[model samples]
Target chain A: MESWEILLQQVINGVSLGAMYALLALGFTMVYGIIELINFAHFNIFMVGSFIAMWVMQLMGFTGQSHVLYGLPLTAMLVFVLCVTMVATGVLGALIERFGLRALRGVSGTAPMITTIGLSYILFNVILLGAGADTKNYSNPMPNIRWEFGDAVLHLRELILWGVSLVLMLALHYFVRRTKMGKAMQATAQDQEAARMVGVDVDRVVIITFFIGSALAGAAGVIFGLYYNYTNFGIGYTAGLRAFTAAVLGGIGNIPGAMLGGVLIGLIESLGGQYLAVRWTDVIIFSILVLVLVFRPTGLLGRASPTKS
Target chain B: MPISDAPQTQSQRRPPLLEFNDVNTYYGELHVLKGVNYRVGDGEIVCLLGGNASGKSTTMKTILGIVRPKSGVVTYAGKPIDRLPTAERVRRGIAPVPEARRLFPRMTVLENLEMGAFTRTDTDEIEADKERVFGLFPRVKERLTQLAGTLSGGEQQMVAMGRALMARPKLLCMDEPSMGLSPAFVEQVFDIIQAINKQGTSIFMVEQNANMALSIADYGYVLQTGEVVLQGSAQSLRDNEMVQQAYLGEMKAQ
Candidate 1:
């Protein structure tokens, strides 16, 4: 294969990975934007989503990719698993907000943020004890079919990952931009006092934001399992950071920016891993984050702190 | 002429749409409102005037329950509202045009206006209210698709007022409607406030623009430190020696 072909292959690989990161990043940006909480646990929510999807697939009697699902049956099973995983994770995220953070709403900024750190640790340990610390295999339903174009090959799972993420992101964008509830969410995010004065039930909006964000993270987890075919307890720690980086890169709190940042981060990871080792990906990502913070703290799409605030 | 300088007599004269009874509020350990007692009568444009940190804004906040008072009762309509949340107060028909016209900068003007009527579920009336808001501020209609933050200061104020009106407010509370505006816009805003008052919406506003506020308001309250120093009809307050020396004494715009 030519050098550019190899780059293209890396690009495809990066986008598929980035799609998952973007979803997680969106959750981070949105939750941060509204409440000013870093929600460290959101990362593990994605991790939990992956674990749930795998367990559900196993429960449904699908074990391995050797006798992989095909056509309608495959599509049906995937849809069922995806919906279940999204709801379960979404509810879990909402519950964390309701029981964990709701009581601490006005108790200074640091309190809730520290609680999120505690929650992240709780989730990490729960999965570690329940599912073990070892990297487990994901039961991928789709057959790993490769499509070649001019010496470059793309996997079917990659397309599904990209397609599903794009559709969900678009749906989320529409829900926020066009719907009345979406406008209320934006109002609450922009000015909580103003939103309340206008009679918006801001608590409900926060709950909804958590649900949507966590649901997207759940979808990303399913796709991550489908694409990488591996899972572990500690994945959220790294992947969540990557998504957070993507959110910042795209301009934290910016919806479209999160998508762009996610893809860009993915590309950088894939390309960097291709040239340098995979171990260097974190160093490069964090270095870029540092540079972005120093030079343009608002980020590529972040116009100013005003918009985020 | 309609009411007396004493707050006790004023409440008996007209059924108070909103009342504060010895309301004391604090932030952290610092006491803000000492003992604020005031009444906004039905269909009255009442203004609270004070210098910076005089607890004028806190009074508005307490009425809206943005900040709960450490002690005392706030009654709206006929019920005790000190315990109600801001959203609940808003549901009971209290709306605020907050300090600095805090429009959702990222949302479009239309979206911001839509948020104003968030409490209302009647779609037909919401559409009608949107039309009413458009009628009140034609410029807001022209910039429906424009991001609210990008609007001019005067236009943003208009949108803010329009947003407040969308709530179909029985009591419209404004905090510093003239805070950041050109002289021309301040007059325009005051005129619109009076016009809204003529439409039968009771207004309770906190302002530093003493002269403009007195001109349109039916009643006025002056706060110094954290207590109501004077309370009466706009005419009497404007005529009082203390109010003139303190608030209207200087013929200057804030």
Candidate 2:
């Protein structure tokens, strides 16, 4: 158990890393599905979510990176903060949709897209001005506990991250496929005019898409913070790009594709960072993105199967 | 030319379910519907006939509130819906079988039908409506689990109609229900449209197949370049030289 099973270790690391990217990628695919906007601000929503979780911990007098609440208390605190952060980020996403993109709905071309980039800057600058340029330590509520298995080790934290991700993703899948509102989202994505003909409030659908997509990003934010132990205004730049690549790698507008793409990219980053020169991680990730786009623009699962959105 | 008793030619035989009064709809600078005024009477199958770019589709869009009238009022069930959004119009007992049968291709036929009743909350009644749709188009029942996109063109049309029926609409607005069907399916579709109209829902259909449309329509309107050039009872229009020449393809061959 003392030996490092490089491959096994890399796979473990990749899954956890991929989990964060998966959550973030969900937001991109959904927003793109419904309104055809990239919502560049979504990356910052994850960053802001991390900061908000940090602040929530701080408000509870748990301010340091060493802030640890174990057993039952830890569970309660994590759940509380996760719920709060998801809501805050969901509302933030909805607000951006309402004021920022609603007016430019039918303006044609990249105006809405450019607005998203502008919105991204606003979110980034707000964090920069409100906090600081320096990387702020995120309070880790869970201790770095490990379980040994043969030559490899499993972190309880990674398992928890993966568990939470799997649940949220399943819930989202059920909602989209089974629930009325979720189907409305899918209907809007396929054909907005047809959706409207059936009496779906397309504008309202747009807002909901932002809410759900951004809320997932918020969860990723908390996970990202817990994994990396710190966050900065610039985290969105690197993390966001990776997640976007993941979304595009899967079908851009596909739900499950984003999740698959996220995990795949996360694994790619981890193994590439370890095996290749650590510096070439970004190049490898983007290279895959370029290859996927060039060869299969629809992503891995973007094939003509059902459940496209 | 046809059965004079197909439907009462009179506009007020029953109360008008939908009315467009001097409504002018614009797509930016292009005025699509020019001061259009029309009505769909309760329980009658009314068809709007026109060629391409003649504002037939825009007329359908205007009634559904997809495109708002720049001026004038659109009334449904005695309420003005000119300013209402498409959702509100649908809520007020209107539904559409849009052109090309725009089904959510990735969804199951059952799911597509469920979506037709998106605005309804009556669980028991929705079930009842589903049964009713299945009864009307029995093939839909067999393909409930199949993805809508996998169905044939004719089957898709059936699902589209079945989906519209799921809403329990008082007024069913259909655009080009016979556009791309084989002659046999076209006949079947017209027969189904009549059957639906007979079941107490009003029909407001826009079609380029004037010959088939006139056969089922109670009343008809002809639009040429965004203006109502001619309108009359189906029998009268079928007998008119202008209608025969322009729409019914009754012109003499060279």
Candidate 3:
């Protein structure tokens, strides 16, 4: 492969990886945006989402061959799995907010942060006990067809992953911009008291924020499992750290910032791994984070003031 | 006697649009509103006057259900609204221009207006109300796409008032509309307050600027240390010797 082709390949790989991170980063940014809580459990939600998808796939007897179920083909079944995973994860996210975080309302900021960390631990343990400690293989049913531009090969799976992430991002943008409920979400994020005074049901807004943010994370989890071909109870820790880094890199409270930051981090990880040793990829990512904190503390797109809504 | 049970004075016979009957509110152990009684009639502007820490804003919050009264009935249009949620009270046509014109700092003026009409489902009416708000504050129309925080103080106040009007509220509650404004802007704000009142929107305002508040209010209540010290027609409060010395900044021979 030519040097340019290698660069292009790395770019493609980075974007695909970034798309996964973007999914998780959005959850972090959104939860932080609404309530200023760094919800550690969000990462666990993503891990659980992937596990749920794997279990569903196994129970349904889905394999590499396209099989029809309920007049739906293999692709449709995948969509079904996606929907189920998203809803389950969304509900889990909402329940965590209701029982864990909401109960800590009006308490010191440290309380909710610590509670989420505890929730993450509980979720990790629950999955560990239920699924066992071994890493479960997540089979990719999609045909492994690759399109080549010169020496840079693009897999069909990468295209689907990128396409879905883009579509979800666009849908989220439309929801936040055009929909009434979305506006209410933004308003509630801006000022809960003012939002209430203006007739916004702030409690409902917080619940919906968790639902959407977690659903996105769930989608990411399913995609991560399908791409990486494995699921484990402990994936949430490393994955959540990277996504949280992306959120901070892009400016924690800003939506577009999180998206951009995730993609950038993905590109850096891929290219850094290609150029340097694969083991040094995390060191490289954290180095970039330290640089950002020291130089431009608000991240690339975040404003100095915490007013993104 | 329960203030709600007291018969309306003969001169003002219409049932009160909003009646705060002997409200007592506390923030933990700190008593904030003590035996407060006042009423705002339909299409009337009732201004609550006090210095800082006099529980004027707390009284506004009590009516909107943010600060629940320990005892007393807060009745809106003869129906008790003390138990209603803050959003529920706002949905029932009570809107507030809160202190410092708390516009969503990051949102565009247009989006802020959208938030004001959050409780309403009638799309056509909401659109019409937006137009009415624009008419009331043309500066807001010009700054529709501008982020609210970037606006000048006077312009922000316009957006805040425009946001409140977008609700098409029956009774508009304002907390210190004249706070942190130039003298000229204060005058302009007061003028707009009267103009809004003329359009059949009753106003319940809390302010320290007794001179401007009393000028536009139909009735007035003087609060001191969480208790109603005096209440009467706006004209009477403006001329009262005690009110003149304390609030109106007017002094006669000591």
Consecutive 10-residue window with the lowest summed lDDT within model 3 chain B: B1-10
Best candidate, lDDT: 2
Query: Rank order by lDDT, top first?
Result: 2, 1, 3
Question: Please, what is the whole-model Cα lDDT of each candidate in the order they appear?
Answer: 0.88, 0.89, 0.87
- Per-residue error at B121 for model 2, in Å? 0.6
Can you tell me the CAPRI class of model 3?
medium
Candidate 2 chain B, poorest ten consecutive residues by summed lDDT: B1-10
In the range A24-103, model 2's lDDT, one tens digit per residue, is 99999999988888889998999999999889988988876667667899889988989999999999999999999999
Residue range with the least summed lDDT across 10 consecutive positions in model 1 chain A: A300-309
Each prediction's total of clashing residue pairs, residues at least 3 apart in sequence or on different chains, is: 0, 0, 0
Q: Candidate 3's residue-wise lDDT over B1-254, tens digit each?
A: 11222234425734588998888999999999998888888899989988889998899889888889999999998799988999888888899999988888888899999889998889999999998888888888999988988888899888889889888899999999988889899999999999999999999999878888898888888888998878777877777878888877642231
What docking grade applies to model 1?
medium
Candidates, DockQ: 0.57, 0.58, 0.55
- In model 2 chain A, where is the ten-residue run with the lowest total lDDT? A300-309
- Evaluated on chain B only, what is the TM-score of candidate 3? 0.93
lDDT of 3 by residue, A1-309 (tens): 999999999999999999999989999999888888998999899999999998888788864335324323656877888899999999999999998889887788598899999999999999999989998888677777799988999998898889889988999989987898999888877888889889988888898999999999999999899789888999998888999989989998788999999999999999999999799999988888888889987889976343522
Docking class of 2: medium
TM-score against native, each model: 0.94, 0.96, 0.95
